[model samples]
Target: MSRDGTGVPHSGGAAYLGMPAFPRAAETATRDDRLRANLRHATHTIRAKRARAVAELDDWARLRQAGAAIKDRTLRHLDHHLVRLEEAVTRAGGTVHWAADAAEANRIVTDLVRATGEREVVKVKSMATQEIGLNEALAEAGIRAYETDLAELIVQLGDDLPSHILVPAIHRNRGEIRDIFRDRMASWGRPAPEGLTDRPAELAEAARRHLREKFLRAKVGLSGANFMVAETGTLVVVESEGNGRMCLTLPETLISVVGIEKTVPTWRDLEVFLQLLPRSSTAERMNPYTSMWTGTADGDGPRVFHLVLLDNGRTDTLADEVGRQALRCIRCSACLNVCPVYERAGGHAYGSPYPGPIGAILTPQLRGLASPLEESLPYASSLCGACFEVCPVAIDIPEVLVHLRERVVEGGEVTIRGTRTTIKPAKRHTAERAAMRAARWTFDHPGALRRGQWILSRSRRLRPRRLPGPGRAWTDTRELPAVPAESFRDWWARTRGGTA
Candidate 1:
């Protein structure tokens, strides 16, 4: 999931290397009945469980506040926390590398692994790695990276990209997974045990057996931590299966590449997030595996450890006041699960490694609203606000979504040199902009608006129930509200002399 030196396409706005906007992508996805069904079932199940889990915690609000505060404080003092984190890792016999962006991060990790003289590395599902596209980068460097997580394994074997952050294979069903395993399993290390069934246990056992050998033989294991305790200089990974534990502890050299935003000020702050994260994400009171490592622990685990703190647009993201809250996200995917849009369109439609509501805002901020895909992402949401409510770190996803939309719409109006220019709007959103401009003009001139309303009322019978031209696509699936015979302004004018 390494980034291709060129910033990964921003979801929905700037199409990656010239792709269609979110509406077009979603229209295509909606046509895929299998994809829609997979998304519907997966999102609903996760959303429901998340709702129930959230309901059980009376202290949830406090916890959310605590999580937000910790993150805010850490980010506010990120430079210091990071330096502290580095010192701790070094003192504990670990190495620290700073990556300015994805390209550097990938190059650093690739070189680090190459230095180890290992052609293959086993990975714990890590978003940072995916964000930087470590797997793809490693591949280009002639190294093979194996995904040890079940869902990641499924995606890797199927030659597919992750749709959901937590459940990378959320777009895939059991049957699809079975087929992927049956078809592609042997090509990568150990084959699936014979007679593997799609039943959860059988499939899991086969994966376990397949990955166990790699875990033992691989000299390097790469991961992303859910939380990096800045004060204690420890890294923490919370996982549902024991696979993360295996990856974290197995290899002779462990490389953890994490976003700078993942740091927390103290261990106690970590305690608050630990409580909030599992329930918000996996809906578990406690995860099956809680692996924490403070550098190397003598002969117990990896003798050599390296922690890569990756920026990759984070500093740019931090520069935006309104959008910076997105940095608080814990990669919970609660927002993704509860997203109505995600349920229908699925993850790939978002285009970046991160998907759904969080991705809609975060990706564009991290990558900037430069690309067509980045520009399109801000409008991806229905603004349902479900994502904001479910976020463990209390990121205001909808607020950030709109903030980014503003950035996209206003990008051309302001120059990097602090001058102004008008960039042509995309062909897709031109009509939308025109309509909005017309509405603004009408609202500003009440007298003309009244006359316009009277005319519309007289011709109400001729009004089309469906939108015309570009809008027809929007109204095709959604019912356009029937226009009333008289505008609300007209009704008010007649009843109250327009001023009452």
Candidate 2:
């Protein structure tokens, strides 16, 4: 990890740091017709398959409600559940570590790997590790982390960022992946086969051959869990590929970095997520590989296990009543599949490991709206509510987006670095606030509103089809609504023959 001039530490190649705000990034992405095409094709296909998969379950809505309720209940007593989980893991011969932030989490993982004396560790496509930039942190510590998941491997080999949640390299076509494999696989480990083509089976075969060597040779494995059972200290990872299973079982030392919100009270709570996750994410009735481990076993799996429970702003997010609901997210990426804005803007535009509707609300809350990048995330959505409809955990993303927008437009007290401080609204939103205030005043006074409407009616012909000055951007893609010849009040009074 390296610090910028502001003394702020960044990792994972600082992929998202100093990024332009969402609107600007989105504008640039919209111009990339190729990127837009890739996103549209991929998201549409996944959403259609998911819709059919979801329709198969008659009690899906009930399951969704149950999942949401379970998450909420666990969050309500999170401290208790965490303590219980730690005790359970300890009893099961696993060491549990708590990290207050990303830096701490990275340090713990690095030290654990260093102690194992392994220079390279195989990974299980864990998002929690990505969130904290663990791969970059390990590299800084002279430890190499190899991505075993095929999409992640492609992204790593190509020197690119993940654009989608479930499928990180969603922006890349089969041809691009083949090219990446042919050119870059040798440097990483195994070389691509001679005359490699873009066929899906061929790509999978090359990735498998390349990763199999790393999996067999590595002594340490790194992972993130989809759900952690508090009662039994078992961690669960669901995946379509067998790479996760290999990472979990093949290595002698295993380390899992997981968000604190992943904890559930019992195994019964786990069953709901299992049903909802696979169908929502991969459109499968169940994942091909469902790996679970409860610490260690005698002469089986990893001999040593370390569980790093990461906070990293989750407690702060919990303080917010409206924003806390984002913690219920299961990382299914169903929202991303259904989001129209994400299809057009692409995941790179959001500038986070998480993309699409879930990212719009989750990123801002987890990091706080401290910078332009974080502040811009809340406005990334179009509020079509498709995200909420498809969410397995029933997170109301649009509601949170609107809430965060209010936070950006009218700054308020927020907890930063454990300090309570009030943040002022951004200077960019001053004109917007002024416009809203003027409209509010006009609506409050009946005579003022009547006069304003009468003036607008009389000057209807003079009104420009497009707005001028700072407002021109709003009208560039949308026509200004034409003014009517008379106000609704006039029509009502004239027809009723009373107030006139």
Candidate 3:
């Protein structure tokens, strides 16, 4: 298989094209004991801390509601906020660029870096950039974009895909990280110091030393914001480490590629998220570094600032009434921590940069259910509702998953890249549809239903332990519930004399 510049198999522009469907990928992921161990440890630890952090707030529920409301209000009038933001940014000596899709966003960023005459740029951790494969695009253009965040740096050095939203290297343990640094650090730039250990501090020190040189020497920096305040043209990036601060401030030129959904109407609206995001995400009262900047400042920070307001299917996503709530995601990864499906199946199974429950809903809507991968994502969950409960913005992910499943089963009109097109129901579900139709027929006729139930009750002892043929797969890891010897109506008739 051919690989992209990033060394992962080419996923065909933003969408995970070559990857297997969710069920196939997840089946494979579940067998990896080591991967499961890593995910179990990391997710358990993070969620426990989050529980403590959330307990510190008496008004967390109210805060969550406020955050959700703020996001909804902003998304409802995104155009107005975007125009206001563009004007505010321009007034602050910043240039704004708009990108309609992933390809266009990559092209604009590549051109901007080329125009600066810089071959190397340092990057803060940004999901928007990852979604567009910005590093791979830059590599194609003969430019090197170094990841400055520790986890992101590990992923880059290891040539691995990110498995989690906040901790990209969540699937890798300390020992694995030590191996990556010891083996790959020199090729990138700085070599790991002699005999580097896997101790947390030593690993962090190695990454810091390695990234420090890039910070000082790089002429340009790239980032994505946690929040973009339209009222003041302010962009905020909250991090446990100060890498984002360095990337935001140290470079001569800074560029931010942010999704339009990240916008907030006012600074007061921004305040609601600041309070909710920390407790929900890193489980901290406040991030160690909360950097907010309003464009450029003379003789301070980056002399030149550029904000790329990227659409990239967000406008189409906003068109959806039920799924649009996913736009409220702050990329906190709280849902991933609480999700049982994510814990077992892992992030790679979803076959997109966004993963877990949010990915199940968001990826299909953003990219459309055109491929088996996208179509299968909506079925990636147990509909446990854990993700919805933990979400700071209350996105109700389970509702959207069921909604997307309906879309997959009974295809209809959908918006794709600003065009509405009709799609046919998936052929793969023919057997399922047939079974449902049979069930409907049996239920509609009272005599047939009664006879069927009586026959099932009489033959309960002779029922097969596992289903035959295609259903064997479903019964492989699950037990088929035993049927009762008596139906409820029969019991009622026998015990209570129903006619009386």
Candidate 4:
């Protein structure tokens, strides 16, 4: 179990543990040609579209600031806002359930669906559901939850975890998808109608036909919301595919599982987020399907609406001053498209529902930084600031990454079999720490740094392409810099034609 400050034993987030550091995982991912090609093509295409979409908005900066401010204000009084939302939901004929953790949340949803005596439930693409592993929990309870979102359906059919937030199957190309649809679609339900080709329309038709059965037949529909309005107790979901519209409205029992952080103080606050989220996420001017329900409307959608306000390690994250900003994520995969690390390594390597720069900080925070895998996530970034630049809410992801790394190093005391002991900072990173400390000391004393530089220049010939000890493995994979005979100080002196 990964331990952060919460001291809660995490059982579900085990996927992000006991893995190699970023460099190793990235190396493995980069070698896979299919994965690389898939990621490169998807990211580049999305990035271009996102840039154009953002450019169209004249008040994008203002909208971004407004989104951030509203979130910050909501978070400041989150307890108050949540209570208000609960009241609004109940008044509007909805049952609101609070989940303290992932297990509780899954249990509530499972029981809710079980009460309806339905073995199969259809799902819209909801990150909150994935975060809590709702499908796995449902399966354990003798129920099967089907993902109806096109990308989610592909990921589900492939028996693979989501690699990208928006396009979960971004790691899969058209060929891979066609293969999945042809082979896997039949077993689930409404198999490909005769000959299903790789063409976009054919694929859409196959999926539409397949999902239409679930939409019409299923008793329960599960979804996650983009925002929850405290003022009106309305949950909003903006989607490209009309499938979300169907799921939200068609089911007899509609269950929405949402993160606590995805709340707004008022309906007006949604105005800002609506503008920011679509452009930042799908690169769309307006989402094709915008579904907002104030609890249950009479003679309209689902008569029974269940809203699960899920904590699931969110309070722990909120406790972090630096990391709490991660909750500001509208899940606009804009950061994923621009992240160099994600482009090369893809999303599966992060081993969480969330991926890319946001995932690096978010997974570690939610799951805690006790395991090697969680610890490695913080170091996954190049600190290029590209993610921050593109962020609609302006979350400083690099700052959070650095902050979490410091926490990992400093806050590693754990009781092993009742004996409290401090696990030394990751064994591999000790040399890095030592080197950094030495550099810091030299930099602090200019005279010592100058002398060290001169000595390094004199002993340039002694430098090896590969370093000794554990560092040798690092150098073996990377280029060693060629030490110059003359140091920067000497070069500057020569340029000036003067010497001490």
Candidate 5:
């Protein structure tokens, strides 16, 4: 690989650029019967497993409470804890770099890889890395970044975007995966067996065989951490597959780019999350593999370790008092599993790396509501609050969703890329906004409210079940409420005879 910092590699549309609004993206996904079946099976299976796993815990609520509190305290004293983490990492003989955003983080990692003189790096599944488009950026720099996780490997092989946070390829069934491997695996590194079947064992064997050489040959590894314990300067990654273990240990030079929000203040705080995360995410009493490392240890794992603390949009997200709670997310993706919207519309519709209920609120706030996609994201949810109930850290996703919806409709001042900018309400929503304002004005005046009700009642027969213009699209699927023949106030007046 050759590198001279002329320009950063374009991450391509791999990072959710130029995508249409949520409804449009969703419309395409919902049309695919196969995709719907895949999501339905995966989500239902996981949802049942998670509920059973969580039910086994007597102190689940307490554990959840502690997790939320710990994260809140950590975020409140985030600066202090981060400094402590850096100090601890340094004390343990590791180098730490701080990046304020994706571009800088990419540059730092690219430079670090260049310094190591390696053209290829193996990766554990890392949403943080994916969000920053690190792999594409590295590709631009002529470095090949391999995704070692099973689902991630499928996504990488198919040249597809991750459809789920926990299971990136949740949208893909086994048959599709076999086809992906049979056709695409050879091009990347290894080819599937002569007759690749979609059987679980066969698929696993194929992936294992294909990735073994890469694991042995790779000199550099890149990852994102699930939790960073400040007290011990230790980082943890929990996974079902042992691939993460290999990615963490086999490589000579390891670079971890992690969102700063993954930090916890102490070992006790870590304990609370350890209980909550596994059950919430994998629905296992404990994840099969929990890998922990402190900086670089001689003769055990990598000889060198670099931790890139990425703040991309975190500081800006943390600025909003109401929106800041999103930083509490542990990336367990419990919320995604239980989401009705995600099950139907799929993950790609929400756009960006984070999807489902989390992305609806988190992406817009993190990226800001400047674009149509971002603005449309807040409305993606039904506000059912299933996401909130399942969140291990007790984040109020629906509350944040509503808060962001207000941000979008009202067009207020918001911070983006560390600058305060006033955003205008979406032009597409102008009619809706006007209608809301007019309704509010009528409700505030008794005479007008009564007059409008009378007009509505008199014109009731002429009313259409479907609306006119843009509203017709919404009404096409949902039946507008049946208009009442008379207003409740009129009934009260007529029945009670205006006196008794």
Candidate 6:
């Protein structure tokens, strides 16, 4: 309060910690009119455009099927393709590093940066870097990470968490962005111009000017690839802005951190995804800029190139028979744009780098259902199947969500950190388990069930509108159907005068 009058907001790139369960988070977000308006407008606009774009292609379904099939095949033989990828990259004179977890990935990147003798890095918008919290790690080692993407720059300045995957700053409108830039831009390196209005052109110009110096001076750059071709070792990055191209080409040292699942078996397999992703995510026939590079080139771009393949918790996710289908996600985020739950509840509630319907199922499996937030994520959705319909790779998100929910309620042996551990049912779910068991036993005894039903029918008037215990809150929003005065079985028997 004494230092800067404008309060310091939390960093958007910071890891999510101590987050409440999805219901609580979603409740808070629903009360926010601004958040609701922003989400409603953005999601509807993108989803509509996506529909139009997809309808333009006669073979879009075929392309989607091909994309799904390629990813599935690559996943089954991931070890072989990953090795082939490594060999191809090595042949192209690039070094490759494998990171089994987030900490290892961070350490590898930090070491590589320190080795470069540069304390600053210009970054293209890479979800992999965000997933590993690389920027924060770099700061710990006394290196500054500069975001080159305009939206990312706003997010970095605002000290906010990304509310969307593709457009990280979708939560904020232009006025909010202008305020962030005016207040925080100078602290970084450049300041917004005097009288900087919130006009799009003015904002764009200001951002361009602010980032020009960083681009020209940056010696190191880092990114995430949309797809990696195993056959040729090419990393493909598709972006609407030209910032990615600058980051890829201008830096003396280039580092790309990619998820193992991002690999496509061949360039032909790569082609299918290229067609699906742009239309699904951006609603464009093709993104304005698409960059593909095969390792380091001779005096052409980055003299030194390094590829870090990150596993993190992916192997654990792959181990889940039902949940592993999430690996097919191309991250188009069409699901997010179409999801009614996502439109209302927003992304941050998911408590992972990935959010929305994908996050609901994927995060729980990737991180395991140990934490309250992770466990609750499985039940965050209504399983309406919009996400399933919109997915480019055809991941059955609802099926996975239900599967994970079953695992949560009926906990058994779960592999945590590659070690098998038996997990007991959560204490909160024990009542539900007991109720279900009681119902099962009653169903086994027809006479007892009939008697119980008759008693309930006789005392129907005395029953409370709201149920007690765990059902209170559930009944708060929805009413239980009124019980009939007489059991249907009794009515049938009286009318027929015989056991039909």
| Per-residue lDDT over 1-500 for candidate 2, one digit per residue giving the tens place of the 0 to 100 score | 44322122234354577777888888887777667777777877887789789879877867887899999999999999999999999999999999999999999999999999889999999888988989989999999999999999987887777889999989889988999899999998889999999999999999999999898898999999999999999999999889999999999999999999999999889889999999999999998989888999999899999999999888888888889999999999999987878887888788888899999998888888878989889889866556876889989897788778777887887776566778899778977666546655765687996786577666766768778899997544343222334444565457532222
* lDDT values, one for every candidate: 0.77, 0.85, 0.84, 0.80, 0.84, 0.82
Candidates 2 and 5 compared: the better one by TM-score is 2
- Among all windows of 10 consecutive residues in model 3, the one with the lowest summed lDDT is 4-13
What lDDT score is found at residue 101 in candidate 2?
95
lDDT at residue 381 of model 1 (Cα atoms): 85
* Model 6 misplacement above 4 A: 1-12, 431-500
Clash number for each model: 20, 0, 0, 0, 0, 1
- Model 3, span 197-238: residue lDDT tens: 999999999999998989988889999999988999999999
Candidate 5 lDDT over residue span 1-500, tens digit each:
21111111112335777777898888877777678778878887898799899889877766777788888899999999999999999999889999998999999999999999999999999999999999888999999999999999988887778889999989889999999999999998879999889998999999999999999998999999999999989999999889999999999999999999999888777778889999999999999999999999988999999999999889889888889999999888888887878887888888788999998888988888868899899889875556776788889887687678767776877888888788887777876676546544765677986776677666865768778998986544333223335544565467532321
Per-residue lDDT tens digits for candidate 6, residues 3-119, read: 111111244555777777888888877766677677777776787788889889877656766777898899998999999999999999899999988899999999999999999
The C-alpha TM-scores of every prediction are 0.82, 0.85, 0.85, 0.82, 0.85, 0.85
Which segments of candidate 2 are over 4 A away from where they belong?
1-12, 434-500
**Cα-based RMSD of candidate 6:** 10.2
lDDT of 1 by residue, 53-124 (tens): 876877776778778888888888888999989988888889999998888999999999999999999899
| Clashing residue pairs found in predicted model 6 | 12-160
* Number of residue pairs clashing in candidate 1, backbone atoms closer than 3 angstroms, sequence gap of 3 or more or interchain: 20
Q: Write the per-residue lDDT of candidate 4 for residues 323-352, one digit (tens) a residue.
A: 889988999889998887898788877878
| Candidate no. 5 TM-score | 0.85
The TM-score measured for candidate 2 stands at 0.85
The superposed Cα distance between candidate 5 and the true structure at residue 270, in angstroms, equals 1.2
